[model samples]
Target: MFRNFGKRTEKAPDADTVVPLWPQNGSAAEAEPSAEDRKLSAFLELKSRMHEALIERLNLAVIDKVEPEELRREVASLVGDVLAEENNPLRADEFRRLVDELIDEVLGLGPLEPLLADPGVNDILVNGHKTVFVERAGVLEQTGVRFRDEKHLLRIIDKVVSRVGRRVDESNPWVDARLEDGSRVNAIIRPCAIDGPSLSIRKFSRDPLTLEKLVAGYALNAQAAAFLQALVEARMNILISGGTGSGKTTMLNAISASIDPRSRIVTIEDAAELQLQQAHVVRLETRPPNPAGGGAVSQRDLVRNALRMRPDRIIVGEVRGAESFDMLQAMNTGHDGSMTTVHANSARDALGRIEQMVSMIGMELPLPAIRAQIASGLQIIVQLARLADGQRRVVSISELTGLEGDVITMQDIFIFRRLGKAADGSIAGEFIPTGIRPQCTALLEAAGARFDRAMFLPEEA
Candidate 1:
């Protein structure tokens, strides 16, 4: 028979509501309280009984215990007054490391974690968790580390994106963040990810690569160095070209070293890698959106911003898109001596890439107008390529001489030819001159630059 009055019956504790904290996916440790606290204590007696009953009735411990420091006071607080009996026992250092442990176990094998430690890895890429790669010596190589699974990868993705105040989920599953080491990180989760979660990190060197070290590394020869120095002194607009592991940026840095100390330089980059040592140098980096997904800064924004700051030279780290047009326009207007690097297989390809990028500027400018922009605004294109032995060499030095009808005209001022190698199997080549000094030598002279022919000797090579 049913009772007329409303009645309530006691409900059983949930057996499956025991969701894990921290990782929300994986691992932790349990530690006993102090012997004094654990032995001969009514509190310990009460907890042990509750634990037994809860485990028997609900198939879960009333309190899944952790060492205070490891559990973290703030996170432990989320468990509610049910854990009010616990002491705040975490020491600062232990808490931090335990947090790291939680992150590592949670994150599993997200590649960016290790990359933050690798000094050589300048960049990292993830088509997805199963496919991860890094850039070394300007070349890409896949790494052995990987996430245990997609969820394992997501935890780390959460920590990183959250730190940078970005997000990744079903709705908006892509984000960019910077590591503690200042490496740039980009991540994409499902929906946007055709595969699993994809990630990329452009790692940073703790110390900037210097010009002297570059010469020692055989990236630039003496004859090439002197000529490049002369170009910088002359304020010639220079574009460096190379394939994906090429030393374009390294070469650009060495060449930029030749600029007179008196002039001001503004360096703009998506990842801020350049390290110029001039007294008046100003460096600007682009910013990705915040966690709430607002406040983004771009290359073109920096370029336009640099103009108002009165830059003597605007050095862009690399030109990958429509920024080529803005760069060329800046070069033509007044930013002569501006230097930048571009991805290309050869000098000709760099030109073509620029031509294509200028098209991306969304203008219907005729090929001739673009060609004219290239010829008039740019002065030289120096090409770099990585050899089999992993050496980055300055292979070609060409000048944008002028225009031929609608086509841009270029002339080689200096070229590197592969002479036979020495007995040691080390690379031996002539960074020989083409016997045509750049016309800009006269311009440099007018600017009070002092130079002589012997200054182009290969001693520095």
Candidate 2:
């Protein structure tokens, strides 16, 4: 129902106006519009009129319960009328790349829409008209695509959020939405966001995380990786922790990759981010409230349900709220090797974070009680970080050796000892085995397995 207003700057236009069309040139005088401007104007006008017409026709057809004609013809007719192109052959020739923009809008996804379709792009962020960023190869990079202007950007934002059955406007200027592809989308308009409409899409990988890729990325050296593989194979409840964008999920995926293929795995997440390889993985995602504001499923609910599913293991993408309590309970109960990730700066901080988050679940339990559960439920905490040199490394791998009063005791099994710096000012470090045997591995040995001890051996190995 809205026209292309373009990406907005500080202020939204007054209520009554359709967003101004994208500037043809750097100017918006709307004169003998520049050729590019002319096409955009024509495109927008055609789409607007056709969308109205299609809706009206559909409403009428609904009353009669009659089927509409083929989508191509319907759109072509509308496009021709809008262009008066049957009589303007010149315009028709120029329009061969005919944009059934409206038809695409009304019937299905539109052009330049396939980016949303591809599951790999993992993230789509729009910085303004000229800069688009996507997450590929686990890194964010700028892509070439711009809205005609802020007005055009805002229009696209509105179209996207509206289709998701969510609202974004002056009163509710920010929106959290999910694309049909299950990509999490968030958008903020002008007053709140300094530039134009700002959008962030947290995209999910179609083929999830695998140990093979983790090994290729140097996330863990072969021996360490093999050890984790065996640990998962043994069903040890593990917790991966780190700050934002530190490859926490990636590490969790690698560790979870160790789960036996035949064991039933229940994975839960607020945004469904984990990509597990187990054939028996049952992935569950939480839902936001609907337009009427009902029917919401949270991570805690899924965790509670997973227990009844008789899961051999339960993995939560991350413990963000009260779900932490349920996750801890699940882990302490019967789910050995149950795993999840949390946001914290260090391994010790991860335990505290869990204590705080579990409290968020509204248990109001004593801090020590929470620490006790975490210590017992989570046998290990693997911390990851993206260092200043733009390299993500395993900062520390620590073990939870039970609790002491209100404090959680942890031992750093593998630490990134800052050996020094490279010639280029880049920080150099290696994942050094603390030389203390990991407590969790005793369980492994008892399971009739052996640790990859030689891999941890130094040059002598």
Model 1 steric clash pairs:
122-203, 138-245, 165-291, 166-291, 222-461
Model 2 TM: 0.73
Query: What's the alpha carbon RMSD for model 2?
Result: 8.4
Model 1 lDDT at residue 206: 74
Predicted candidate 1 versus true structure: per-residue lDDT over 291-318, tens digit per residue: 5667988898889899899999999999
- lDDT digits (tens) for residues 317-422 of candidate 2: 8888888899888888888878888899988788777777777866578877777777778887788887776567887777778766777788876677777889
Whole-model Cα lDDT of every candidate shown, in order: 0.70, 0.71
- What are the root-mean-square deviations of the candidates from the true structure over C-alphas? 13.2, 8.4
| Per-model TM values vs. the true structure | 0.66, 0.73
Error of 2 at 16 (Å): 31
RMSD of 1: 13.2
- Model 2: lDDT equals 0.71
Poorest lDDT segment (10 consecutive residues) of candidate 1: 1-10
